[model samples]
Target: MQKFFKVYIPIVIALILTGCKEEVKKPADSPIKENEPSSIAVTTASILKEKPKNLAAPEGMVWIPGGELKQGAVPQDKMAMQHEKPAIDVLVDGFFMDITEVTNAQFKKFVAETGYITTAERAIDWEELKKQVPEGTEKPHDSVLQPGALTFKKTKTSVPNLYDFSQWWHWTIGADWRHPNGPDSSIEGKDDYPVVQISFEDALAYCEWAGRRLPTEAEWELAARAGKKGTTFFWGDDISVLQQRANTWEGEFPVTNTKTDGFELRAPVKSYSPNEYGLYDMAGNVWEWTSDWYNNNYYKEVNTTGEVQKNPQGATIPFTPNNPYAKEKVIKGGSFLCSASYCASYRVSARMGSSMDSSLEHTGFRTVATVAMLE
Candidate 1:
């Protein structure tokens, strides 16, 4: 699993070398024009053509006009890894997507309305353990069953090379969406935070209840790119002035988050500017779950299947090219915790996985759908 290489960095470097570089410069003044739709104020009316204000935010989908966009690394920068190799031409169809990640407030409403219990909210299934762990590996001691992971702060004095997730990810028993830390913790003040500890099934349930569905991996990526064809980021390639653009690691990775991005964990929904399509926080915030299986080679398979696949869910066989414990659903968009010192998956092609039974504070979700024809 450790041997599996991450493809984002190398691809980004390669793209920088060959692709037209756009300096990521922050404008001193607001760039919104009177005639143009404000990225922050996008309403459903904009996407669906004249709907109620309440319906505006829930436009629920965006049209990703299909076209030939550069699919992989062009120059193959040394930093570019092999998984994102063999750059190819691919296209995607228009789709509707949530304007923001499902917030704790929204997910709480789902639970309140349906009494739906998330997988992590329930006890671990003992029967399932038999399939993975050694026969006698004592049902994971209680100390190991705690909720939430320990986020370390790395400083000049602290070690930075550690990748052991267990050192941070503690399997706390009472840690679910409502209690991010454990039963002792609560969501009382964190209603605006992205709902975490959600399994793929949990996200699906919420989407189904809301008359929506999870976005395919392709749809998610297209949306994340926000109609900015061939750009490294939804806004542009320049990585500087990052504090104003997206929520990401400010200082050293796991250990020392300077909170320069105005956040330590997750931020309120719509806290950041939306991409060209009016999608907010698409780059960095929380790693969102998509409706796809884990497969390192999914992109290659997608290329072969079709150039403009409508819904490109990943292959069925569980496989994580980089992170092995991530053997369930695929996650996209690196979270606020992402850092160059550690994981640089904040890019468009980056991927992640979470067990159907497992959930974490860093994991959340958004929804998307095919564009609804004007009614």
Candidate 2:
């Protein structure tokens, strides 16, 4: 479940070559940990009744009324992972969220206007890369250090196990959001599809340009739950309906994708029905970035009191045993790579940390606007 196989390019490249098998746990594989408060639960059950401002909803965004959210995996979720455990209620003020993951057309516009360059299009910085990896690690060859992003290359046949994800995820040169598959791929006719290969930094830049911001993990969950209660998925608990409801890896992952949803990869936004809040692609399509510093034990801090945390921003600094040096931010939703047999990250409570500078074929993002910002 460690999507950060590309978290630190140099480290991951070395690890993949040696078949590093250390288990990298995510929301789908980890067991719940005992309660240990890192800080006092200061924020408590609070709700914002009136909208922050009465401005009309921004175009292509919807209003998610502030409410009490049972954030994280509910007890009913048999497939829950540790990160989504200790489900805690959180309060978020009313905000406007993009109706879909930011589209290729949208990102293209931003680049054209601002002359913005995505992380994938930038050359690897050895100095920066080394900081995120262990000491004494040798720099990668100059040739392999070119600009690129992680692209999913499906294995022709089944592998021994699903744990080693490096078999399918490869670092491909020139695989930016514009060329999702690599140098050969282009987003030409797919303007409406959710843009992939977007790093956390790229998403933030886009948000600033658009006068919005990435949703907090809490806000993302609140919007994804879409007024639903006790449901494993944003749509509902029924796993059988996922194939029809979302564009997830419908077949054996890393080996075969049956294209059961008419999309072997990403589908255009709004291919499926929207959630109760009129949010599309909230449960799948691609993982969306949230503006929260990820800490594996942060949930315990908020859940200790069993009270709703108001607009809970995450950890002050990113820390996770899996990728200790990698600065990560919480990314929500799942992707087309998600599957029930493998990482069923499409569940509403499912969450994972992505290295801020890492970009992948299966990752993208959406933005949200506070009512105050709208005013």
Candidate 3:
């Protein structure tokens, strides 16, 4: 589902922090001696030097030799969302990530081998869903509880209310990874396209069978930035640069897509050039799932420490004020539906949260393999 709620203070604070500022000078009469190695510093240095055993790269994946990232939106972006605020120094360990989003062909292989069924293909559990809803509320109709997914349908005219995303998204029965639009649609010729209509659990299942796992939010952002620091977009600060670099809406969103980027919907996995790290579709195509539980204020926790966060696993619990009972995971990289006039989440630092059980037509994911996997 589209998230358009505006809470601007956090992002404004992030923007202010990104600008050039005077460095704080140490007190001349401070008791601690300068250059004296603290325990934290010593431990951080040791971790940086420790190397894991070399492993053969998984096919269709590339190694990201991660370092510290200024992980958040840059000051140049006035459209920065509140959740992308308070850019912090985060350190992630090197890991192997898929070169592109998990393709339909790849997911098909996993399903065929395991006979796995995705979340969207299963009937909804009314008993479990009732716990999340208000007590004593009337049960939804059986048709509403049928196996289905949220599918995007472009509007014939400009939507009267952009915030009401229901205008473009519909719960369509028989719409899963295989039948993207509905029962009438098929993935017959779209083997190379990134798989969509996936949930966090569905992606995790594929990862388990493949002997991989979803990347942590920190790792995903680091890779998407592609070694670039403090830039609005992954490529650069200029918004115009996105014209040929990614698959995002080129016209007024929901109403019409000009297809200036040669795509009305999802483009092939690597339709655009790879990022500096040799990772393709790192910016758009489909939002990739991360292992971390989402928390809008998670960045504040990262800033509490002087030592760089090493592969942070996000908050202890997922936090969504609107849906407290829904366990949500972080999704990064935006998707084909992103538009400057509507959803600008295509920016590297942007973050979105989706329920673990919620499947949508625009959502997909990639997997990551740690060095330990080799052993």
Candidate 4:
């Protein structure tokens, strides 16, 4: 979903015109209480469950078997994040995962049943922020400026040079699961498209309603690998001929997309071939959410535990400096944004983070159901 909201010049303009241009500063939000003084004495080794068999997603997902496998980047691959470092041997219990992300039709069912309104669709409580804005500066009646995720373009700039994401992230008022592009855009014709603009809470709500849960970071990575013993991607290690497999950036990212993958926006679930495990679009399409809090030092911390972590979730603290949004959770599997020019995170080992409260067109989730009976 890289700039799907803005890759085309006309769409970008439309976003600005329809979007509110208010700059609401992130307040001193609640701390993620990861550092609870009363820590549980549980260890990863003690909570190990029996491994389950692999199977295909019933209708929405694929099966990921639990077993011992490499859990991080191969040695010499520097692209691995600090949290993805200290590659360790990890084992997982078998689980059923959505073959692809939850589609508009599938998610719509959950929303209809629960009547859940996602965070994206909710209007900002501007009244709460009235005192925060400068006294002299009045908010624009037509401009949008509350906190919201922006769609970025690949400008003629280096990766490190493109830090100013404010250029693309917008604060749309009516953007949500049903209206992905914004208030004006609807899911009427896009039932098969992956649902977007979903927050972590939004995803959790849907999973609960469906009797599923988001996968742990380890489980998500294992499933994305799709039983490719030593391959780099879910299909295979060699991404040299990636165009045939995943729907990633075929040309310049952010600025230009050749649409070699045959899609300028999101493709329908299972649009691509499945892996050995029968999982669809595991590498590209949308960045899937995991049930883990983010921490750059999480890997190092796990290694010292002397056993596997049980249904582990990430710490609530933001490990990066100046990134108040660091407290956000981890997401894996690169979106359509992956490219040699930037964001080469389409690999199975690649990882990224996003704020739990924030939503983006590129961000979505799949369900992981624990195997009821392990063989």
In terms of lDDT, the best-performing candidate is 2
Candidate 1, residues 219-298, lDDT tens digits: the string is 77767776665555667677675677788877865567899889887788778888887888887888888887866676
For all predicted structures, in order, the TM-scores are 0.76, 0.89, 0.86, 0.76
lDDT of 3 by residue, 1-375 (tens): 113322222221111111101112122231222112223332334333223556677898888875766777676666666566666666677888899999999999999999999988987777876666556755666755678776788889887666555556666778999998888988999999999989888999999999999999889988888888777788888788796899988888778888999998899988998889889988778888899887767776665666566777887987765545556788888788888767677788888777777677788999998777856
| Ten-residue region with minimum lDDT total, candidate 3 | 14-23
- Candidate 3 segments whose C-alpha is farther than 4 A from its true place: 1-44, 47-53, 305-307
**What order do you get sorting by TM-score, best first?**
2, 3, 4, 1
The superposed Cα distance between candidate 3 and the true structure at residue 121, in angstroms, equals 0.7
The whole-model lDDT of each prediction reads 0.60, 0.78, 0.74, 0.64
Question: How big is the RMSD of model 1?
Answer: 10.4
How well is each residue in 349-369 modelled by candidate 2, as lDDT tens digits? Answer: 887877777778888999998
Residue-wise C-alpha lDDT for candidate 4, range 1-375, written one tens digit per residue: 123233233222223322211112222233222212223344335433444335334565555666555666654343444456555556676677777788899998888888898876565555643443334444444345443443433455433433334444554556677767676777898888888878889999998888888988888877777665545577765667677788887775556789988887678887888778777878788888888776667677776875645444555454533343234577888778677655667777777666666677778888888765323
- State model 4's lDDT: 0.64
Best by TM-score: 2
- Give the better candidate number (2 or 4) by lDDT: 2
List runs of model 1 lying over 4 Å from the truth. Answer: 1-63, 72-80, 134-136, 141-157, 301-310, 321-326, 371-375
Question: How many clashes in candidate 4?
Answer: 18
User: What is candidate 3's TM-score against the reference?
Assistant: 0.86
